[model samples]
Target: MSKGWWAVVAVAAATAACAKVEAPAASDAWIRLAAVPGRPAAGYFTLHGGRADTKLVGVSVASVPRVELHLSRMTVGDMMTMDATPAVDLPAGAALPFAPGGRHAMLFDVPPALTPGKTATMTFRFADGQTAAAEAKVVSAGASGPE
Candidate 1:
């Protein structure tokens, strides 16, 4: 109603418009070496959730046939198994961990060029159509993850 009130509202609107929240960021991404070349490899990374909650609907990597989110959990008393999942839910400001012997990505049919000291591009798609891209470095066969 008042001129001062209107000015404050306009400034608030401008600030909100400038702060566009985006999808989570992938950091410390790396691909663990597979004993046999061309075999499936495991990937580890840390997902730093954005200002808003999001869902990881899909993933893709160069020179890889298939990329899927996987979970390793104990089943049937003492046995552990891995299974593919459709999507990964990410809460705001959450730190989702992906590592060996835990939740991680299964990179199927990876090429030999993805050996240690090499890098690969990985694109992650979110449910809102937003995407996050990161570089995945190839680590040693006995390594766990990025430093």
Candidate 2:
């Protein structure tokens, strides 16, 4: 091969190596309003991992005053408890589900304007410093959630 061709190939390889990994994605997002007034709402979704492994560190909604990640687990004596989690690990190409009775987001101080059939933008923060925003369908508390 010519020297110029070799140089071109080297540059191409370097560029490929420096390529950025895909950001994480969120789908099937929905927020269920609290069944009773003055209660925290719940948010659920499926977080699709990016091209590399990362940690889901936080989530936020512009309308909501506070949001926190939580895990619901069945404790002893058939009791259920929800614990606040700092982060959730996400492997490459994995789908992490946030559903009822499992991992979910507790959206506190939700505005009254967020009614059923409305949509709210939720931003997912990753450890890699990337943020993914998805609009969450607002549903009534009695609703079964997104399909």
Winning model by lDDT: 2
- Write one digit per residue (lDDT tens) for candidate 2, span 23-95: 7999999999999988999999999998999999999987898999999999988999999999999999999
Backbone clashes counted, model 2: 0
Model 1 lDDT tens row, 57-83: 888998888999999999889898999
Query: Which pairs clash inside model 1?
Result: none
On TM-score, the candidate that comes out on top is 2
Instruction: Estimate every model's Cα lDDT from 0 to 1.
Output: 0.85, 0.94
Report how far residue 146 has shifted in candidate 1, in Å. 2.9
Clashing residue pairs found in predicted model 2: none
Worst 10 residues of 1 by lDDT: 138-147
Predicted structure 1: lDDT: 0.85
